[model samples]
Target: MLSKEEIQRYQRHFPLPDFGVEAQEKLKKSKVLIVGCGGLGNPVSSYLAASGVSCIGLIDSDVVSISNLQRQILYKEQEIGISKVRLTAQKLKELNHHVEIEEYNLNLNSKNALSIIDKFDLVIDCTDNFPTRYLINDACILQNKPFIYGSIYQYEGQVAVFNVNKSANYRDLYPTPPNPESVPDCEIGGVLGTLPGIIGSIQANEAIKVICGIGQPLIEKLFIFDSQSMETRVIKIKNTNARDTITGLIDYEEFCHPNKNKMVKEITVKELHEMIENKEDFQLIDVREPHEVEIATLDGELIPLGDIPQNEDKIAKNKKVVVHCRSGARSGQAIQYLQGKLGLENLYNLKGGILAWADEIDPSMEKY
Candidate 1:
């Protein structure tokens, strides 16, 4: 069914012993939706495009920042200020003009998630946050689509294929998300630059295998990688009643934290702007390290949550205190420190942290 030019274009892959013309043709007919366009999405998108996935959809509302240059291989310095979905599509187009690259320049919230997932043949969860990951998992299960899951911590990463028909889902492996504040993000905990690159490529591999109907998929098996040790671990998972109960993308944000009222205080990036403009007399504290300050400046004192007690004098008792880190998790810890020790009456958290602030307020600020 391929034209002369189509045959010539995929000539190299077509001649392979196991993956011949059939595999290449399968790739040309498959459509994939990659969520988050970030660390994991960058590598997944790049490899899938290069391998000639016919229709690719990139969903992200983020812009390329200087700090992302470390591992987001799809972007360059010139594309710094551009939206992630736009720039990613542009680059992927250049890589393979034969592939149809689509862009959804919006965050994957509850409102648009179902409509988006229904359009693609498969879904890739490259999102960094727990809320979005659970959302993607639930949505894929409801839609009966295959979902490739990837997650990374300091130097470790996990990958799996979830929500496929007759296969295990994300909830089957880990039924409940950890306490939001209990886990640290890549910004707070830090990740090796090449970590996502390795894991995401594996996710893309699973996608390709699914399309070609070759090789055993990683379904019901969670692959763990420790880059430092150059070791990989595969943990087997089984289907459960809990996964069956997941009908659709429920309030994942609330599901992750059932007692939202009793949990940490939350605020939006817009709220932070309002407080700043109104000249709120709160002790704005930045918990990020001093080196990170060289790239971004916040209108707050730098106490570096790790060294908070050493600089306790900077936090006044009577004044309101607002703490923020890269993405608000550490800021919650800082809040706990201040409240437990200083016992401040008025304390607030800049919910999504400085990264969210940059995304919402100033696109020019570099995100770490």
Candidate 2:
């Protein structure tokens, strides 16, 4: 029962063969849960809201930063430090008042993944990390809810529909997560501002098709788009039967990364600050980008996450090495690589990276 305003707002879609009031009513009755409110999530939620999806759940554990303004089109510089989920919900409401926005300012981990995912009819995997992707895939399969998956690298991106019609899923595409150090994220190697826009729009298109069951969805197929070459390819996704082995939600972090249980030392910002005060003999490594160093930096050598392999000699062999980034994710990855691959042991990750330093040690320093 869409209102008069809703009818006029979605008038453009009424021209489809069978997508008039009947499809609009189906859209109004559907519920979707978008796992991430960044890059792809921005467009996916925007279109879904305009199409008047009854309930759109937005979940993210990140805050808006000036750096995110590049690809995440929904945020502004003024909104920095605010919760992304909250910001996205507010903006979606403005675009379509009739659509309901449910915001969760929390990360999706093994503990809450299944229970939360069970509530929605459909799920959209807009997450960036591997652990979370695997968690979403396993949970969706267990709950018998279909999910649309989208992931973007610098210029190339992949999109697919999973668990719908018992089709191939993420596990078929990637049987196991690669080493964290081997894979570089957008933060380490920047993404073109327009890349996510292209991939995200496609993700939204597939989402609508799935919701209405009007068009052929991306079931058992993966769509690959390259912006630089403007090449598009669709590959058949053959199931590895990995879904059969999944009995329940296991530790995703441990599942995605086997080294999670490894003992990796971490030093707190306060401790590092104390070391600074004492003039302790230690080597500080900044695993962030050069531009990130310009934004905010500590007394450390700049060696980006991707360039870690070639710059192995830069790490001091005699002194303790402390790695840091925007958050501890990349830095921890650096420590893992240093120990596992390079066989270096004198390393420690900054507990929470510069964000921790900004909040605890130096409030004047910017936190991005």
Clashing residue pairs, backbone N/CA/C < 3 A, model 2: none
Best by TM-score: 2
The C-alpha local distance difference test score for the whole of candidate 2 amounts to: 0.87
Displacement of the residue 304 alpha carbon in candidate 1, Å: 1.9
For model 1, which pairs clash? Answer: none
lDDT of 2 by residue, 1-368 (tens): 87888888999999989678888888899899999999999999998998889999999998998778989999998899999999999999999888888888999988988888877889998989998999899998888889899989989999999988677878999888897767878876668899888878888888888888878889999999998899999999998777897788888788777765475788899899899999999999999888888889996999998789899888888889899998888898878877877788789899889988998988899876
TM-score of 2: 0.95
Q: How far does residue 5 in candidate 2 sit from its true spot (Å)?
A: 2.4
